[model samples]
Target: MPARNEAGNLPALVDEIAAALASRGPFEAIVVDDGSNDATPKVLAELKRTRPWLIPLRHAVSCGQSAAIRTGVRAATAPVVATLDGDGQNDPTFLPAALDALAAGGARVGLVAGQRLGRKDTGFKKIQSRIANAVRGRVLGDGTRDTGCGLKAFRRDVFLALPYFDALHRFLPALVRREGFEVGLIDVVDRPRQAGVSNYGLWDRLWVGILDLYGVWWLIRRRRQVPEVTEL
Candidate 1:
């Protein structure tokens, strides 16, 4: 999970992840500290001592959410990686379901994205998201209603193959589809944040993604043919 200055929420969120996935099998939770000025780094350090599954990474300067996620995913040792907002809004319990969905679809499903139900944001924020989702879905035809939902599961290799960008996380479905892989969707219930104010604003939510959207559209339209290979 990518987090900035979310010191108050990390402990509980990490614990929840442990509770949700510990019994399933071996897994690691990589929390990227994106140049947080708060006690986020310290808290992660303290938590690391006890929870071997918790892997903490830090950036000296903030490079935004997409970069943070890239950092964590790169460091992850697992073949399949599940991601969610570091804030407490996303429930960790859904991780198994997402992973299952992705596994069920096998190699064809490169991504299993979460679509939020009953968003907890303010009315204006909801409106902005609706407008953004509509525009993005119509233009990209990604067939997803909530690309902004942070909960997602995919193969680590598949994720690394995509072209990196500032807002790559927001256009994952479209880009995954562009790579000739199907995208799966699961309905996730949203929750109000447990602590700290939201770091994203109007620009971060809607306007900033416009250019990235177009770039993804171009990439999709210009997709190269993947040749079938038969080696005797």
Candidate 2:
């Protein structure tokens, strides 16, 4: 989970995740605290004492969400990694199902992404997302509708091999496909945030996203096919 100033939401989200994944055997929940100024560090400290599965990491200064996600993925001990927003808007119950979907698709499925239904964002935000998604779809043609949804499951090695950038989290499907793997989608019901306001703004993503989109498009066009390797 990539979290910034999400202190109010972490405890409940952690508990919910534990409950949801308890039957799935052992797993680690890596919460990357992206330089939160609030009581976030303290809360994580407290949560850590009780929950061994909680792997709390902190950035010395605030990096964006993509950086945080990259940090968690790099540190992951599991071969498959699942991500969700740390603000409690993303339901933890969907993680197992997403992982299952990825597994069902076999080794070629590099990413299983969540498509949010009934978004709880303000009308303006939802409109902005719709416009962004449409533009991205036309430009990259990654066959994904809601790339902004935070819930995702993928192979840790595949994720680490992808080109990293500021907004890489939002472009996973395109990049994963560029690496010659299939993408899977699952419908996820959105929920209102448990606490705190949104950390992102229209300006923060708009211009950068355009540049990133073109970059990904170029990468897709210039890519070479993956070689089939057979060794003696």
Candidate 3:
């Protein structure tokens, strides 16, 4: 999970994820403490002692959510990786289903994006997301309704190969499709934050997200074609 100053939310969130994933199979929960100023580091440190499956990574300075995600993925030892928001809004209960979707989608499927069914955010946040999704769809044509949802599962290699950007997390569906892969979605019920304040501001990212959308559109247009070949 990518987190900045989310100490109030991390410990319980981690435990909840572990409990949810317990009966399913082996899973490690990695928390990327993205230069948090609070007691986040201390909390993670304590959790590590009890939850050995928990992997802790620290960034010297806050590099945004995208950077933190990239860092965690790079350090991930699993073939498939699952990402959750540090704020505990994205339900961990949906992770196993997402994993199943990836497996059932066959090898060509590179991503399983979680689409929030009934989002628990405020009216303003919901409207901003709706508008953003519409604009992004029209521009990039990624065919995903909710790319901003934090719950996602995908092959680690597929993510590592994609071009890195500050807001890459928001455009994952389009990027995954651009790499000759399919992206699947599963509906999930969103939850309100367990504690603390939200670090993200829709207005702060509105302009940058627009630019990123257009950049991705150009990328799709310029994407190179490869010919099928066999060894002679």
Candidate 4:
């Protein structure tokens, strides 16, 4: 998980996620610090010293969540990668279930996105998300209900193949679909924020999302399709 200034929530979030994954056996938790100005790096370093499973990476400057995600993905040593927001709003318990869905191989699904049920965001934020989701669904036709939900899992190879851009993290379903992979949706629990303020606002996301939507659309249209050759 890529975390930025998430010092207050990191301890609990890491602990809960670790405990949840313990039931399924070993899994490494890569915590990438996205140039956090707060004590996030200190906390991660301390944790890493004791917990070998907790790997830590730090960016010299603050990058957007998308960049942080790319860093973490590159550092991932596992076949399957799961991502969740650092704010602790996404439930870790649903991770194993998302992995199970991916393993089922329903139509070569490349990404499994968790749909946040009963979101706990402010009314304004929720309204903005609803509008954005409606627009994205109409434009992309990716069949994903909640692309904004942070909890997601997919094959590591599939994730590394996608083009990188700022805020492109929100369009994973559509991008993965363009690669001829199906997207699976699963319902996940949402929780109220326990610490720190949200990094996004309504107007900023709205304006940026509009531009990103068009950019993704053009990329999708211009994408080249090549047949896979098994034996020459």
Per-model C-alpha RMSD: 1.0, 0.7, 1.3, 1.3
Best-first order by lDDT: 2, 1, 3, 4
- The clash tally of candidate 1 reads 0
Weakest lDDT window of 10 consecutive positions for candidate 4: 223-232
**Candidate 4: how many backbone clashes?**
0
User: TM-score of each candidate?
Assistant: 0.97, 0.98, 0.96, 0.96
Off by over 4 Å in 1: none
Instruction: Please give, for residues 171-219, the per-residue lDDT of candidate 1 as tens digits.
Output: 9999888888899999999999988989899965555578778889999
Model 4 TM-score on a 0 to 1 scale:
0.96
Query: Which whole-number lDDT from 0 to 100 does residue 205 have in model 2?
Result: 81
List per-prediction Cα lDDT, in the order shown. Answer: 0.93, 0.94, 0.91, 0.90
Candidate 3: RMSD over Cα atoms?
1.3
Model 2 C-alpha RMSD to native: 0.7
User: Distance from true position, residue 181, model 2, in Å?
Assistant: 0.4
lDDT tens readout by residue for model 2, 117-222:
9999999999999999999999999999999999999999999999888899989999999999999999999999979989999998889889988998998899
Better of 2 and 4 by lDDT: 2
Number of the top TM-score candidate: 2
- Number of clashes in model 2? 0
